[model samples]
Target: MEDIVFLYRLVPGHVHHSYGLHCALLAGVPDEIIKRAEVVLDAVSKNNCVERLCNENISAQDDEYKNAMEKLLTFDIDSGDLNLFFEEIFSSS
Candidate 1:
């Protein structure tokens, strides 16, 4: 959460917001279901984030993919239904 909040604060665009969110989810979540979620985020995962080293460029505009992610993020999952739930959004067990 700390890293995510910090990254999110540093970046002021939709693409970076999603990237920060991906870092939070991937870094914090358990291994079992990681691949499941990865399949969903695969569209946004590209270039290995080493743009300078690899000199690899990928477009940041994919509203269709982001819209799909928005559907995933915006859904209310019975509060603690999330295995990788955001702590700030959760109050109790």
Candidate 2:
């Protein structure tokens, strides 16, 4: 859970919220992590979903969010695989 929060802070804002949600889901995190992820997801959805925006813009953002999620899911953290995840994230940044 703390790792999730650290990862969330490590990523850029565009992908930060979704990163934590995806990581928590992929890692099969505990209830507390799931709850936190949901809050972040809800806030992000609300902020991104603008009523007057063009469809293309919305679609692009959705695509980017999905891509970010997929990227996070690529790392297998099933057995508490934090080192590789952290290494990948830090190296990439």
Candidate 3:
């Protein structure tokens, strides 16, 4: 993870232990939830009960939120679509 960096939006690209937290922040997740995620991330990164902790925490989320997240994760855009989308966006800029 130290050798890898995500490029886009954030300046100077920083490495993250949990990119999902970055995505959650970008998606406007509540500050409290983000903080809680940070705690869980810290625990897991330190080799604490990773799987059990994750399952216990995530399983507490409501079904509606889970379904919505599942739908959001199902996006299947290919490179061509991405190029076209970016062209459409930057062309006007």
Q: For candidate 2, lDDT tens digit of each residue in 1-93?
A: 344344324554465324655666777788865875576567666775423334786787777667657768886667657777666555653
User: Against the hidden true structure, what lDDT does model 2 obtain?
Assistant: 0.62
Q: Is candidate 1 or candidate 2 better by TM-score?
A: 2
Better lDDT candidate (1, 2): 2
Give candidate 1 misplaced runs (Cα > 4 Å). 1-5, 10-13, 16-28, 44-93
Give the per-residue lDDT of model 3 (tens digit) for 2-92: 5445665655754454478878887799998898888878876676864444564566555546655554466456534656654544454
Against the reference, the lDDT scores of all candidates come to 0.48, 0.62, 0.63
Q: Quick one: best TM-score, which candidate? A: 3
**Distance from true position, residue 82, model 3, in Å?**
44
User: For model 1, how does the per-residue alpha-carbon lDDT over 24-69 read when each residue is reduced to its tens digit?
Assistant: 4657876534655555455455544322212223223344446546
Regions of model 3 farther than 4 Å from truth? 1-16, 50-93
Query: Which residue pairs of candidate 3 clash?
Result: none
